[model samples]
Target: MNKLIEREKITFHKVKPDPSSLEFGKYFTDYMFVMDYEEGMGWYHPRIAPYAPLTLDPSASVFHYGQAVFEGLKAYRTEDGRVLLFRPDQNIKRLNRSCERMSMPPLDEVLVLEALTQLVELEKDWVPKEKGTSLYIRPFVIATEPSLGVKASKSYTFMIVLSPVGSYYGDDQLKPVRIYVEDEYVRAVNGGVGNAKTSGNYAASLQAQRKANDLGYDQVLWLDAIEKKYVEEVGSMNIFFVINGEAVTPALSGSILSGITRASAIELIRSWGIPVREERISIDEIYTASARGELTEVFGTGTAAVVTPVGELNIHGKTVIVGDGQIGGISKKLYESITDIQLGKVKGPVNWTVEV
Candidate 1:
């Protein structure tokens, strides 16, 4: 669409690794898409070049001020030899929203989508056909202007790279995980960049995540910055609860990432004639519900894991087992349903999958 992304000749190619042995985000494809933005020249010079390292100035704004944003989505190779992308348009739209929030130049959604499709098509051979493997696409923008001032940079670099990844879970089995309820550290505030997929928000989460890991937990469950009582999100996914037969998740209170998978899960569950509500759910309420044996299940949703069952939640020093400390029926159903749609095994909602 944008002048047919210029491709550099590939002199050599990397050998494909064993899909079962693949680790998440460890192996990259042969090519990548890149574009640049200037203060007055706008975004230009879109190209598809050989995957290589980037050279940036020492004082680049991104390194100094951390004005960067990124998005993640996967490309799947179906059994029929078709390449499918799940809701790529939504991912591109969210990328632009993150750009706007970080004071970076907004990309043309149509152009971005076209570039992504082209890149994935060029690297179609790298898309794993294994049962739990897919191509992980990372599209990001970084402020490139070499300056130290605490302000937005005048230039930026937008790029997309693809990695063939195995299943996000370490084990082949989809086992439930233990989560540490984080009250001492805050991931974001009402006026912060929590809603945006920026680097700082994640960097700020490392301390709590490390503490959780030290305490033998798989992930940290964050709470609201203001009240420090309401549940926000898990380490990298949106948290959900099935209390008294109703699906519940924290409302988007300007401090929570509006996850696409979270929204899709809600829609799919509601389509089954079940009730799903987006509202404030405090930690105390969850504990109380578990105490009363009313909390049936707890799960998390994200592009990485798709659906992760929360077997145990450690609030402060008290731990509560959820649904026999095993993967709930709802969690397994949602995981299978979403994976089915992604792999083209079953038809999903209209326009949910875009063929590459």
Candidate 2:
């Protein structure tokens, strides 16, 4: 087992925030895991230290060239008094893939998982016990070399922090969100860093998100970068459409993120005898399906929100309401199932949750 040098914090937050009032990522736990890497020295100094501000040089490569990657997962406090992580290894694997895409060194999978498990165990009290509340885990790596250059940095820092969070949709009951489809702005192309979970990819999405907000929508559903015709994903989660009584989602065409929740949803739906198709879906096709009364449901899947029902979509100035603008059967089932599995309300797949 890879062991992290544990350093107890001299001070802890005097009062824990009310779990019911937890806006997403607003309150952090007392401790965090950190490690460093150099070109020659490799990754070293693995430790669990007090949560504090990071001091980075003004000219760090990550500050200029954006050589960084991140991963998000959650630890749940089950009703049975056990802590569980949902597919944390998948997050580490995706992190390595993002690092490879961003010209950064890959992390040791075993060590990273150990660090996550240990950190979550040590800070188990921070995992909210309230229903629909959990400890959000953010694991990120950044270029830390102190120099101004357009190339990859010679050194890096990896960290894992925990934040107690409530519902992603601002409430335990997820209302269908209005999504704005951006025809003018595209997020990522087939041959871009869009597939990677890097910082700049999100940084480039602020404009589209702002547009969505200004348009009275809750989220932005982005299109392909080059053709701008095919559906890619939503700003935060992977988009899916229940068309013609079947599940349909945009295929991973080198641009769409392969979300852990998205994959699990597909598998879970299929297990329940629902047919899921991962193929190229177009905005026009979605509107056409809606017109034909075939588009029964629309939802987004991610780590934060196990399921986000999409009620309305504004496509190039035209508004299309999805199936009476209410949460569909599939979306509701997915949310309850995933949450149940995470919180040990019911048994999930054999390998889905890792007990801590």
Candidate 3:
């Protein structure tokens, strides 16, 4: 692992907000970890410094061609004062995958993990202890070479920032959300960068999301690009449904993100002897199942919300209610199980929670 150099000047401050009133990504800690990359020298000069705005050239490649990637995870403060991270290594691996897809230099996983641990430890006091609250970590890489070309840049910057956040949806009740099924403006297609956690994919999704919001829906349910019939994912999470006592999600067909939370939920559900299947699920089949009373529950999984129950889905102008328009038993169970494991309330699989 590359040794991280510590800056001599230290800035100590605190942002102790009422945990119950915390908003996602609104506030930041006092310090940030950063590293740089060059074409021939590779990554160098890793350090943790006071949080500040970056000075980049107007012609930076990231500003023009949008060569960037990011990853999100959380750190929880256990009741006994232990700072625990949930599946951080998996997030790092996915970040590397995103780097490769975006043509950016891959990060040294061990060194990055070491840097993350050091930064989080230094700012451990910023971790919130209230229920449904934790420290959100955002790591991102952006191409920095100043050029107007359409090719990948020779310079880049990687940085990690932290925020003490409450629930992503701002609801202690874990209320079910209404989703609008989008049949137009496809999010991504097969053989594209859909699976990569890059900025462009999200930028391309803003229009549809705005439309959903304007229509009084909480999120948009995306469909496959070609047929536009099969379900792909929700606006910011992976979608799952319980039909006929079986748990099912759309398989990763090179066009959907393989979410860490989604994988963990699948594992936890399967461990309970419940049937789980990953396959292409069409929207027509879901509507038919709802009509026949076979669609019992609908939920989404991601690092942000963990598990979001889908109470209603609007297809074009038609609306279908899911599981009596409330949180299903399976949704509640999965949410509780994952949150418990994350907060260190329950012992999870070995190495699932890493100490800061």
For residue 148, model 3's alpha carbon misses the true position, in angstroms, by: 0.7
Our tally of clashes for model 1 stands at: 0
Most accurate candidate by TM-score: 1
Candidate 2 to native Cα RMSD, angstroms: 1.2
Per-model TM-score versus the true fold: 0.99, 0.97, 0.98
lDDT of 2 by residue, 67-154 (tens): 9899999999988789999999899999999999988999999989999999999889889888778999999999999988578899
Q: Where does candidate 1 stray beyond 4 Å? A: none
Expressed as tens digits, the lDDT of each residue in 74-96 for candidate 3 is: 99999999999999999999999
Best by lDDT: 1
Give the distance in Å from residue 340's predicted Cα in candidate 2 to where it truly belongs: 0.9
Flag the better candidate by TM-score, 1 or 2: 1
- List where candidate 3 sits over 4 angstroms from the true fold: 1-3, 12-14
Which stretch of 10 consecutive residues in model 1 shows the poorest summed lDDT? 1-10
| Candidate 1 pairs with clashing backbones | none
